[model samples]
Target chain A: MAVTTLEPTTGTVPTRRGPDSPRRRKVRRQAWLFMGLAHVLTLKQYLVGAFFAVLELLFLISLPQIVTNLANLVTLGEPALDVPVKERPNSLFMLVDGVITIALILLFVAVYYVSVRSALTQERAWPPDEPTPPRRRLRDTITGAAFPVLGLAPTVVLLIFFVVVPLVFSTLVAFTNYSAPDHIPPAKTIDWVGLDTFVYMFGGSATWTAALARVFTWTIVWALAATVTCYFGGMLIAVLLTENRFRVTPLLRAIFILPYAIPSVVSLLYWQNALNGAFGTVNRTLLALGLIDSPIPWLSDAWLAKFTVVTINLWAGFPYFMLLIIGTMTSISKDVLEAAEVDGASKVSRFRHIVLPLVMYQTAPLMILSFAHNLNNFGAIFFLTGGDPAVADTTTTGAGGTDIMVSWIYKLTITLLKYNQASVLAVMIFVVLAPFAIFQFQRTKSYREGEL
Target chain B: MSDVVVRRINTAAVAIIFTVVAIAVLWPVVHLVSAAFTPGRSMANMPVIPFSNGFTTEHFEYLFTQTDYLRWFGNTLIVATATCLGTLLFASLGAYVFSRFRFTFKRPLLMGMLILQVFPSFVGMVAIYVLLYRIGGLDTLWGLVLFYIAGNMPFMIWLVKSYVDGIPRSLDEAARIDGASNLRTYAQIIVPVARPILTFLAVTSFTAPWMDFILPKLILRSPERQTLALGLFSFVTDKNNFFTTFAAGGLLVAVPFVIFFIATQKSLIASLAGGAVKE
Candidate 1:
């Protein structure tokens, strides 16, 4: 790891010297001078560095002037303009500040340049006679290995700025009195207020509490109902399509996947119209068959609205589940099922014992992810009902009986402009889902281990 | 001989059950199309008879005449096309680098991308809105496209990277031996090999902007810039023209995508399934 030297004017000489040698002192002096000039050449490299240095200098020289101006502006108002603009800070003082700022900036630039160039120069100066050391090779390997990190810098920076910073800012907002039409920054003059929003949500304020409870209940019910109904319904379709006796299995499979391929919004709007009580196709067909006397209030009544939304979600979601299950089912070894069949297992028994367990085991992780997705299902509920059957209460903002936590948060931010509360809700959602995320991470690790 | 007969019976029963289920599954879509064309007492009073008393192209006419339906369609096409092109370019390049290069922080970077999918993008809504507003992207199609790309990048990068990873490194090595640089190797070798996944990505990416409503609603303030999904919302909400015209518009939106999906279904399914298994 010794530094290599270029040919010297005196001779082909090694620059390695004892610590107290005069040659060492002369070499260090030359290195410092080279570093200083290199720093001057790379001014742009230290622009950000220079900016801070200048800011510090300005603060020191201009603090008194700024305070005096602020006092005049506050006290004299219009009269302050009649006074002559104060003389610029003393010239000698300004010069000193500027020089000091420049010096610091130049120093920073010099240090950065010398370090980089020396590293590069030393790397190039390795003697032709000696082999590169193992330790050096290992260091190079480690450094080169960080290429992916360099590649991911933009995405990581974006995630921090857009996702992490906003999340943290919103979480902080939740603990403050930041509310509609007057969201002030929490500066030194302002005091922090904590947990008032949460208290209001859960306290004896009947409107908020009732809306909270209702939305929470519906969110859980919707998630479970949508996930389970889709799971079973999809499994059934998958089983039917894959059955050896089915003549038109491929066509059936294609048709089943149609709902999934169409985007969820399209499906929701299409179904919303199809389910309209007054002129919808479903009611017409039902009445044509004499199934009911009057059209059902599918989107107007609370329970019916919730049920319709869930059913639409199930319709939209199941096809993907069906696809996943079918894939899983096909991957099962045919010989295992053939063996069971030869043993005289009934069709139901074979499905229950052989098909179901295998598919379930393989698709368990996907099913869990689906559950999380359903819990945060926003598009279906928003486009279909817009969380309709609006609760009669006004104080609860714009949330309806069908609102999930996500939709409720939307209502808070967009419709009501209760951003502080929305932030609180967003944080709460993250908190609620954190455990599942951790579980998923752990599962991925173990899965990797198992594969190894 | 008796067991053979029983097996035949079971087969017949399974076929019958499948047929019944298929009918149930398909009935609604058939009803939707038929209702779209049915002319008599709206959809609510249609008879079981196959032929209606009258048939008309009146709904389609109304959709074009009375609403900004065509304009919305055009807007959506532009947005979806731009989004697809942008996403494919950036995501493919990023995915290629990650797949081909031995770089530091690769593992952490991949994990970070995966973790992003767990949190919905709406969590950053306020910040994005303010940032876009300050930067003058608010109320513009470009703003919508930016959000769309950002929202979809994590999944797209993972997908493209997985497909790229499946391609043999020897291809790159061969190209390099032929004196092609890294960029040339990617363009001349890797991309051509990854065409199937690229097509899948394109279709999915294009379809996303066409289907999206929330982001456009948030960002695009002017009616002139409203996309098809938002435009369809107007038709659905308008009490007078909600029924027939809404059906017509829905049919219009669904048909193109249905055809596209049918054409590319095999490749799409293969790419997705392959990615999942490899991941």
Candidate 2:
């Protein structure tokens, strides 16, 4: 779409000055300089020129400092005893400053590009006999450009500082020694330790490597199981409701969607309590029914807690998929199914060949997204079990049997202040998840059609 | 006769599965209501049946009288409302530009937003925490609101852009021809036409912060500033026997939330389906 919208003009301009004229070449070269068009610019045009000039001046001024910041980022900081304490080397500060500087430079380059493009446009539009007045030129550019500039500026700036900057800072944290009680800022300085954290986590120690292996494997399993179970569970419920002609179908559908309707945090927490080993309602009712003499360790056991969270996730997750599949099912034309049935396909085969393929085509991307979401489904495990009923490696690694990569990252950074390790895991999650994101994007209509 | 027999069997099978699944799904909800109304301080004493112990408003009463329930509700309301309004403002603005204008990096920027959503925001939470500390946003409600607004930007922009893309340019062009400024045309024309999707965005964004736990837990550490999720979570975890009270508080939020969700489920799903795929 942008290609269509931003195509360069190929039409010839009727120039009073000849094609090889010196004047035309001069104007073309002048378009690259700030205030170069001042001879032809009116008062309003001068103001526009002044605005871009100020931006250019700011960009020039910040260039050296940005370069210095980049240099300091590589060195982090040296504990210069000659400097005051406040001016002393803080690696965190340097890294943050470096990231900010890069964001600023990107912004400045965008502005520079816009200004130059506007200047060229102004030059091209100049008349052969009588040029457009400066006031009119100013109005034209403002109308053409100002709307997007004003509209996008706030969101763009916020994303740069908040989302992009922090991501860069975290990515950089993996290469540092910013852990607490030794390398914390303002008292102790952190130094760059390239790939050491990664090496340590993967093969550094027996406990850590084992913990990483367990959590990573479980993360993949949880993502796969959660996505598949929810998808099929919803499909079953949706098919059952749709295929059956029951008087109570609407009521059942309404009741089934309760988990989806209620906030997930509330539901997960309530389930945690209901499954309590000693005092939970599930155990209490089971005891009253004489099913078991002792309470079951629902959230206390390592393996059961994993099963409990996944099953409970089924209850919490299925309704959304049910609704989505039902939506997709409604779009399946009756003619297609009827044709399949008439071709001697039994009911099951008709569903398998016709309805299943149709529905899968529409909902598969969502299923993949669901897998990605489950990979970091912190609240599902955190609130339910707090990754508790700790396994052998939990004490050393701060990871319980149910802890996924994101939750483990939380435990490391928030509870243990292991910034270096947390960031390494964060980077690993990014690596593992990026392929799924790219795959989804490639399947999107925008990419396939080469239009947005 | 065989057809009738097969239909009967099918109906019987459907009924059996429905009963089992329905109980499995609805038991927790039923138990939550029971726990909230049962006359007890401890969940251990309560029976399984609803109203078996006789109904009492004591837990709800205790929630209001003893805990910071009202304060937490107010804080949550404030934060959710602000996040909704803020998301609406920035996302709609950014979306309008994306839909209407042809600019450099437009495609790359959109792609960047998609990629950003892939990287979990919590991974950078340490940097976020430190950033907030530097800005004096730690332990403040506004800081949480700002963070939520920033987090909602990428997806909401794409969603709202899909909606805005459908509006006929003629309407805005007509307004522009009548000497309306771009802002005026957007405010007076484009926004009203895009109301359905915007309303969907507003409702979803509002609901997000209401039950969000982790971000509020990390950012807001004060007793009085806790959101509903944080406050209710503390009820069971703290050194108190307030399981019933936790139930009471949970329902207070859940009941209204469920009602709102059900009321808007049709449009929400419709808009999501509309916005997700670009045909």
Evaluate model 2: give its lDDT.
0.80
Residue lDDT tens for model 2, A204-286: 88899999999999999999999999999998988887787788887887788799988887889889888999888899889
- State the C-alpha RMSD over the true interface residues for candidate 1, after superposing those residues: 9.1
Candidate 2 regions off by >4 Å? A1-44, A58-71, A80-89, A136-144, A338-349, B168-181, B238-241, B272-279
Clashes of each: 7, 0
lDDT of 1 by residue, B1-279 (tens): 698998899778877866776665566666556555767424444445533545777778777887788888899998998889877876786677766663334455566666666777776454455555655888988878767776677767877886786787777777767866555666789788988788778877888887777778778888889998888777666464455566667777777776776676555555544444555
TM-score of 1: 0.76
Clashing pairs in 1: A145-B104, A146-B104, A147-B103, A147-B104, A148-B103, A148-B104, A149-B104
Error of 1 at A49 (Å): 14
- Each predicted complex: what DockQ? 0.26, 0.50
At residue A340, candidate 1 shows an lDDT of 99
Error of 1 at B31 (Å): 3.6
Model 2 agreement with the true structure over B131-226: per-residue lDDT tens digits: 777678989999899888888898888778867877887787778679776677778998999888789889889998987888888889879899
Q: Specify the poorest-scoring 10-residue window by lDDT in model 1 chain A.
A: A1-10
